[model samples]
Target: MKHKRLFSEIKADLTKVEKELDKLLAVDDPILSKTCVYLLQAGGKRMRPGFTLLSGRFFNYDFKKILPVAMAIELIHMATLVHDDVVDASLTRRGRPTLAAGWGNTVSVATGDFLFAKALEMIGKIDDPGVAKILADVSVEMCQGEIQQIWSAFDVKQNFKQYYYRIRRKTALLIGLSCRLGAMVSDGSLRHMWLLETYGHCLGIAFQIIDDILDIIADPDEMGKPVGGDIRQGIMTLPMIYALQSSGHRERLGQLLALKNKKEAQVQEVIHMIKNSDGIERSRTVVDKYINKALKHLEELPKIPAKKALRELAVFVGERSY
Candidate 1:
């Protein structure tokens, strides 16, 4: 089934929420308003909002009703990115200057806070304490994950367990919450909600694992960022972990990590070594494990077109090249 098109069907509803987000964030300050609008207009995959609406189908499919929840989840995600650009010192996203790069760090930070506050305001409009509670708790976990990632940087000894735990908080938790709250806002049964949440959790993990691999394999034009970014930042993701496990390349990996300022030549050399060191295959294996678990969760969901779309989504993440 071509579930890729499923998201397109909800394009109208998603666009509506996008408009609401813009209206809510309308500020008087010219620079601040421009920065916020610039980021919003650049747009992203809108994957969190997609998760919310898709999961909403099993309970009560009302785009108008659940739009606030979907928009709130997306705002939370955008807020994280606005801060992440500051943390990573990123110059580009989606092939354009980041807010922090264009504006200043101070301005960027306040804008992120403003977006986050807007998200909270939207959540309050929903009037569901359960949804509000999960969002607040997940926001804290996301912050914790970011902190741990920053702390662990340049530590070559960091292991797979630590890496997994960090990504679970940074990436997977919000995606899972997006789906869970999507179902709740739609009034899904407990069982259905749980199933969707499980699907989101495993799928989110798989998505990030693939993203890590893409960071190593994709070109800047395709990935919309410089290659070897995580490596350059001294962040060891799954592929790097598998590379470290190799007895033969331990010394080489150490040399690559120990370097203070890595040149293009050195980064390419390490990239080539990692491509041949079975690290790529090992990371793929781990991703498959999570994808299988996600498919299992899909099997338990009610057999509907939307559920089928979710299943195809799992497959797409595992196989997508971009």
Candidate 2:
């Protein structure tokens, strides 16, 4: 809420993105349309599109050119979420049932594939071969990140470096690309594009770190899923990684986590111990570090209104209440 004005500046542009997204996702099949529309109606922060629009403000602010790329970036994000729901078998997202939870996995997977293909179609409209290649690389990196998560599931022995790379691939790359493509479409200076990418990458990493933290402490009603859900699925997030590396309760936490699958009660017990330990604090500190890194990039931008909003948006995401 603190940064409402940041979004307000580009309210019209965002509305256009919403309309464009609806048009893109529209299909002939009733079931496919119903399923896809259901997921779209659940809605999201639309942060990807917002970032794309704001970054474009650095140059000519050509809403005409930026719209296509913004919509495409958001479409990719939605596609990833649809696929993630299938992989996680998540019951809920944003306080609503997930696609895989409400419909079957078969439909959900198809919906995700549809979104991915449609996103590429929008990119093709731009007719920029370079943009298409960049997006393709992002898809590859994200898949690699998902594979890493799958391989590392339930393994607590891994270090912070692995976790950092995983988040960078799965989350940061898309965000950075959003900023880059926004600048690219407007033909902004190469230096400006680089700065925006740095800002986006740092802000994205911070965004995910806080997200993982929220999975530990946020109320189920607000978070759309039960707290400690990641631990239940044996995903070792940053907070748990820090707590496991702690000397005091490291062994105890490991023992509890090892039994999380067989003894469900251990999930809450591990959550409790993690709260009591230094894990949460340390993770929060790391979140601040990345946010500061983003702000460093923000500082170099010219005295544009978008720059202020970008700085505020970066800080708001790092400290978002939810």
Candidate 3:
């Protein structure tokens, strides 16, 4: 399997990352430590950190210097997940009860805050205001994205531009930061850093689009939630947006979404309506576009093993289901 192959190639470094993450999460309060560990252990591809590590490799930078930045990127990602679960009222993630589900919202939120603080501490060790400013800007964009998400919920009138920028703020900015900062810390050329940032941004947005598709079609066990989860939550993802715009069932979908609380059958109806339309295929088309954009950025970079691995990583991003 490519999964095993990928891990085998990066095993030693990833092990270091895992240990660093665990050490960083250890805290004074047992409850805080336990909750943070629980969330971190919830299985994920760790793709953000993986991208950071790969970008760092372009300069063949010291792994020790890169580790703190890579770890900080991952910590930010995990922090977002914890807060996201509470915001979405998600009960399960990766088939385990969420921090919000196992503990309460307050505890979950506090744990997320702790993670953010720790991430900032790691950034502090770098001792660069420029780097701190980058994270600060991304953090502001992320909060704005969350606000936009709440306002855009169940919104049928939303256009392509609105959805595009929302996902950029929510996912792409930090991903771009990871790659750019990886290069920055590696002392990469400005041209190389910006190119990597662009690559990361395109890849991250595509990743989110695929995630939404998986939320519709992937197995519950694999997806960590039931199908139609977004539909039930009234989040208008790309598939749903396309369906609302083009599917003949738009009226019925609109009617269903009008309800303050959509029932199980109604959510199912919307899901199938989306699948039966051009939504899934069209959404894939958009994913492909972003991926192509990423590949173009890679084209400008020097031919190196890390660059090849990044290309493979881009393919993996598109093919990955969970």
Candidate that beats the other on TM-score, 1 or 3, i.e. the better one = 3
Tell me the TM-score of model 3.
0.95
lDDT of each: 0.85, 0.85, 0.83
Q: Against the hidden true structure, what lDDT does model 2 obtain?
A: 0.85
**Model 1 per-residue lDDT tens digits across residues 1-322:** 2443757656677778778888887789887689888998888878889888888888778887798898889999999999999998988888888999999799999999988998998888887888888888999999999999899987889898899898999899998888888899899988888888988999889898888898898888977788888878888888888887883777888689657578888888778878878888888988899989988987877777778777778888888533
Regions of candidate 2 where Cα sits further than 4 Å from its true position: 1-4, 259-262
Lowest lDDT block of 10, candidate 1: 1-10
- The clash number for model 3 is 0
Please, what are the lDDT tens digits per residue for candidate 2 over residues 92-137? 8888889898988999999999999988888888768888899888
User: Residue 223 of model 2: what lDDT?
Assistant: 80
Order the candidates by lDDT, highest first: 2, 1, 3
Best by TM-score: 2
- Going through the candidates in the order shown, the clash numbers are 0, 0, 0
User: What are the models' TM-scores?
Assistant: 0.95, 0.96, 0.95
By TM-score, is 2 or 3 better?
Answer: 2
